[model samples]
Each structure stands twice: as C-alpha cells, then as structure tokens.
Target: MKPGPVIRIDFRGGIVSPGDLYNILVAAGRLGLRRASFGLRQQMFLEVDDSIRNALCVELDALGIDYVNNLEGFPNIVSSFPAEEIFITRSWLSEGVYKDIFDAFDFRPRLKVNISDANQSFTPMLTGNINWVAAPGSPHYWHCFIRFPKTNIIYEAPVCAYTNDLASITACLEDQLMKGEMNGDALFGHPAMAHYLWKKAEAHLELPPFNLPYYEGLNRYGNKNWLGIYTREEWLSIDFLKSICRLCLETRIGQFCITPWKSIMIKSIEDADRPRWNALLDQFRINMRHAANELNFQVEDQNPDALALKIFLLKKLNRDDIRTFGICFGIKTRPRSEVFCNILIRRRAMIRLGRWSFWYRYDICCSEEFNPNKRTAWVFSRNNPRWLLPEQLRRAIIAYYDGKSIAASQQVEQSNRQPDKTAVQQIHQCGECLSVYDDPETSFGDLPAQYQCAVCDAPKDAFVPREWEKQSA
Candidate 1:
C-alpha cells in the first residue's frame, strides 16, 4: 500500500491492555479509520486521512499515546508471550517472569530485541539485535546474543544475563553500540553490563527445528478458552477489533497478545462466554481456521507487491499440493529489513515497464540446514523474475529434503564414498559440538573458507561429513 499519513503505536512485548487498545480503537473509529493492521514486530499500524492526520495525532497526544511515522528507529521489544500458554512447556519462564522483565525496563529501547523460548519454534530466536533466549539455570537465565547494527555479524556474549539484569544489560548494550562500540563479543566485559553477568553462556543454543503451531480459531486451554484471530487480507476492521475488546473487558480478561505472525490471541475466555465469542465471529463473518499453508507467510508490513506475490505463489502451491509443512516463507521488498523465515524471497532489482509501471526481479535464499532460527541464510537462486518463484521455491524445498535424506544416511565409506542409501540423510558435522552443515548438495570446496561452527566457533576443517538420524514433524 502507498504510504499516507501513517502513525505506528508500539505495544511493547506484544502485550496490550484491553482498555488501552479499546481507547485507541475508539479514537481511530471516530477519525474515519475503519481498518488497521499489526506489524511483524507486534506494533499497531494505522493510516489516517491526510487532512485529519494531525487531528488523530492531537487526539493521541491528549490520550498520552506515543507513535512514530516510519519503520526506521525505535524498535519494539518482541517476546514469545503469545505462545506462552498455547504452547505451554515445563520451564522457569512464566507469565509473571515475563511481566517482571517488562517492568524492569526503565526506558524504551532503541534496538530490536527478542525474548523467546529456546525450545519453541513458533517465535524467532535471532531476528533481533539483542536476543535473550531462555537458558537453563536455577535463578533463571537468558543467553544473550547480539547482532551488530548494519552488519550480518552475530555473536554470543561471554556471560549469561540474569533475569533482573536484562533491562540494564539491554540499555547498556544500546548505549555502547550508539558510541560505536560494535564489538558484540567484547560487550560482556563492558563496565555498563559487566556486574550483571552471571555464569559463562554456552557457545551455542541448539534450537528446536521450525514447526509452526496452528494458532487460529477457538481452542480449549484447560477449562477456559483462547481464540486466535487472523485475516487473510491483514486489514482488520475497527468494528471487529472493538467488538473483541469489549468482550474481553466484559469477561474480565485482563490482556491479549499480538504475535509476530501479525495475528492476535485472546486468552482466558470463560467457557460460558464461548457462545458470545462465536456469535461475535458470526456477526462479523470472521473465519479463524485458515489452511495450514496460508498461515505460514510473512510479508513486509503493508507492502502491496509483496502480498500480491504471496497470493500468486500460494495459488500455485495449493493447486499442486506442494508440501511446505516445516517451512516459513518471508517476502521482502524493502532492503535491510529483518524477516523471520526458513525460505526468503527478496527483491533484487526493479525494471521499469512504463512511466507508472515496473517489474521486480527477486533473489531467493534459505536458512542454514533449513533451521528458521539461524541468522545465516544460504543463497540458492538469485535475480529470478516474479514468475519463477513457485518453481524456484519448490526446487529449494526439494533440495532441503534431499539434503535431509543425505544427512540421515550412514557415514561416508573410505573410498569415493557416497551417502548410504538408507532411510536417513548424512551431512557434515562439527567435531566440537552438535552443529552440522546439513547441506549435502553444496560441495566442501564451495563452503566459505572462514566458515565455522555457529555453535562452537570451531574452524571449518573441524567439520567432517557424517551421518545422523533425527525425527521432526
């Protein structure tokens, strides 16, 4: 969509108070905005009529609302709270823990951050510059990983950050990076965040492989119910939002969560209130159950071309019954913006067709070993036209399975060995840790000379082609 008079409201940690959201909705509804959207970072996206843009701004100001006009600067803190109860796991991480961490922040952060469960594939682990992942510890700990600004270099810190120190460490890191202290590996010893550090952090966090849960529709959670809402167009009606907010207020539901998937989850709906929720959905003709594949897409916020391309590719994939069960697709038309996906479609260059028309060529890449949490993306095909995406993406998927099969194969034989034709695939493994370069198609000679185990940071020569068996959904 074309940019107009726009304002973005940050809902820190994807957690929103019902009343706060309701008030904003009322303000927007009164100002002629019947539609809105949520961003991948869990912020609210609003477009005001150019003539009354300032008027909306005035109303927000009176209501003590803070908003920005563009995608640059002031990144929101992202957390896996949306998946907390729905994808519940036995861990020290709890709702109170999340709330405490949020409360510890004395000031808004200037950097993107992710506080996510290490075992959950529903939320990304490395999409932020400052990532505090759930780690094993008695006092509760988070493994801090930092991605340097304007660069692809992501590194591990020397110490794990205690829960109480997350805020101080975050603010300190932001301050230091602002002063051109871009060394991620050295940040642990910085005086600003030194004392807050605890035990030495593990060199790598072996995350669960990508497997997105079906996060839509009314679902049973204990005695209560949680309803997840998503719109294919992503343009949610203000009336719909307000209706849900009102229900939440009436039912005494304290809060709701907006996900990085650009959807909302309203939890703790009483069983008695189920009919009311169903009636509300019926009244608005909302369908919460979307096809599994339809729910796995991430488009650049409010990008028409990206959405269009998504629609086109989906049609082809569905028609062919393409299997994309374990993968997430991210479409990017904007340069240098982070996306959470196993398969990435990026706009490389545009070709002008007329004074007002143009066509874009794309580049395709996938995460290392098809692991969505890794920041590393290995290029497959580049400079592909729009029409070639479905085919190219299918081939990439095929490559993933082929590599997977090869990795499950037995160890290479002594002479001119090929991967064993067993049920498993065999790939390269690091001598120091469990990290493996699981791409069998890519020759060893073609691997980057400086490439090392992302987990152990062992030299490239430390990796040898090997076989292993692992099971996943």
Candidate 2:
C-alpha cells in the first residue's frame, strides 16, 4: 500500500505448496510483477523436499525473479543456556540457526532473516546480510538494517495468542507508527486472523473499512452471479493497508494469511454450493444478533463467528424440550462433536442429566469412531481425545462453572415462590414417562447424574431430574 515496486511475497511454506506456487508464477508473469521475496517456515522447509525446491528455483530463475529467502527453524537453544550467557549466545547462534534453516531448502535464491520472536536479541546480527521483517521487538531505527532504505523492514501484526497482552502489543505498535516507514507488514496466520489484523491496521491509521471486493473479485467467473468478492485489490490499496495495520495492533486471535491461489481454491469449493453457504452464514448472523440482544453483551468485532456459535449452542443445549441435534451438520469429524460438548459443559448447563454429563459424553464419543444413531442419545465418559489448544479446554471448564451458578440461582428463586395447593396437585398428576420415576420418595437431587433416554434408555445425558422436591429438602 505504501508505494512503487517494493519487494513482494513472503513465501510462508503453506503459501508455497507446489501447485500454489506454480499458479502464483503464472499470475505474476501475466501481471509483469518483477522481483519478490520468499519467507519459508521450518515446517514448510521439511515438507518440501529437494526436487520441489530445485523445481521452484528453476521457475523463479526463468521468470527473472530475484528473491530474499528467510527459512527459519531451531531447537530453542537459549532455553538450556545459563542466565548470564543467554542473551549473547542467542545473539550469536540465532543468525546461524536462521542460516541453517535457510540452507536446508533446496532453492539457491538470496537468503535473509525475519525473526518472529522480538523478545530474543538476534535481529542485529541477521540484519546486515538479509532483510529484517519487524514485529514488536525489532530495533533498526538509524540505518537500513538489511542494506535498503526504510522500505526494507516488513511490518506484521503482533503474533496472535501472545499478542493479547495489551501493554507490550501497544508498545510495538507505537514503535512502528513512529517510524512512519512506507513498507507494509505481512499479517501471517489464519484467514480470520488476517481479516482481524487488516481491520486493526485500519483503525490505527484512522481510516474507513476497505470494501475489499470492489477491486479484485474473488471467483474466476468475475462476479457473474454476485458470488465473487474482490479481496486483493483492496489489500493492495494504500488507504486500506494503513487502516488495517493500525487496527491489528490492539487485540489478539482470529488473524490469518492465505495465498491468493488458496483463496481461489476456497472460492471454487464454496462456489459448488454458493447458495447453501450464503444461507448458513446469514442464519448464523441472525441467530447471533438475537442472542446478543438477549444476553446484553456486544460481540467482539474480531470474533463474531465464535460468539454467534456460542449463542446458538446455549439455546440448543440448555433447552429441556428437544432431545437430539447434530453437532456438525455434514462433517463426520468426532472432534467437532466433542468441541460442541465441551462448550455446553463449560457453560454449566448440563445438570443431573441421565448417564454421563454432556461434556464427558462428548469427550468419550469424539475420542473414538462410533456410529451415531439419529434418534438415540449416546453418552460417554473419560474416553475423549483432547484438542491442541489448552485455552479451549480451560474455557469449557469456566463456562461450566458459570452455568452452574446461573442454574443454582434459578433453583433458589423458584423455591422462594409459593404455588396454589390445587395448581401443585394438577402439576403432580402429569404422567408421560412417570414409570421412570419409580422412587417417588427420592429427591430429584438423588437421581443419578447419568441416565438413559425416556423411550429407549439408550445411555444419554440429555434430561434433568424432575419432581421429588420434598425428598431433596
């Protein structure tokens, strides 16, 4: 967004998949885009063997592309160093580690270093020989650290998850803002995160929302069916970049980057059933708005989808009337089901349900492959496989505690109200599955937390205890 003919392409490994790279080259040739850079990740380096790298090098050479390579992977060497020696050793070994990683990739293009972790003091050593992509901790104020002018340093949003700490993130943003350098930053990570960062950058720059779809339409069909959304044209515009960089500096999570080809691929996949995708999104947005109104909580701009999901989940799981609903509509993944279950458990909405609490049940089911019956409630305990994010697990637990508090309050409030004797008698006469309540003297609290379904007793955790208040008292 800043200006004319600066280096492009921070070739993150995911972006450089063989097919994707080929497409990028073909597109670049058509556009007459000369000179670009490659930023490869450690995982990507491992994934790409010699043949692919050599092939890529040949393609770039043929296209007259001069590249800057920053391939990085290390064993976290400083963790084992003595306190006094940590900084110095890190300063020295980090460059070599960068070199080692870069050397591993078979491409013979020019190499440089882009240090992701700013806390480490390795930027100075790697700066002179190669390009330095700045995050929060980079120090290259006086001179062009990578032998270029202000344009050499590539700015990116503070790393996600870790960037949640506002003080540090703000400090980083202030530094980049003060520099007033024209070069842009790579908002690397997930699509959601990338979009969040883009908005954040905009806020920092005091600009308006860049309607991305106006310039480069998304689909190959060129917006024929109102399906394609223009994204890159928006990204390439200076006004848009400035605004996004400013906004991304504030918060964490939901930031990501995807290759152009990958974006195209996703469009192709969605285009197969565009109406269905659009409808689902529209329904989700409506549900979210309704839930937010009910809860009196504003959804975060960065995570509306997640917030919407939570609202729908609360509505569905906490309902006492409905018995069964599919977690993942068309997907067959067990983890998705487990994640839904975890959300319910953490919200603390599953109280005294028939066998296995919902969370436990989901954990067990997701951990293994079992045929799910549409009409039957399947309950499980202690056998679920955990996910990669510990934070997710923690959230589930917190939600459970919160839900419990709400439920306890409701119970206490109900107890404070007195009902007419005749009305109570009429309520007690209700009989549809009364045989299941064989022990009338047992308080509802005494009922097992786990239970089978009303009709089939297929082990389930969907229903709560009913009646028996006197016994509980």
What C-alpha lDDT values do all the predictions have? Answer: 0.80, 0.28
Candidate 2 error regions (>4 Å): 1-47, 61-473
1-473 in candidate 2: lDDT tens per residue? 01222223344322223333444445443444332221112111111234345555556567555442222222111110111122232233243333334334443223332232233321112222222222332222111122222122323332332222222322333344345433334223323333322222211111111111211122334332222112211122222222222222222211222322112112222244455435533543312122211221112111223344435544543452322221211111111111111122211113346643343222211111111111112222222233312233334334435555687887889877775433211112113222232224443345465633322232334333444433221
Q: How large is the C-alpha RMSD of every model relative to the true structure?
A: 7.5, 22.5
lDDT of 1 by residue, 53-146 (tens): 8888888898898788766668888999888867857777888999999889878888888998776888787889899888844457888888
Relative to the unseen true structure, what is the Cα RMSD of model 1?
7.5
Residue 176 displacement in candidate 1 (angstroms)? 1.3
Indicate which candidate wins on TM-score: 1
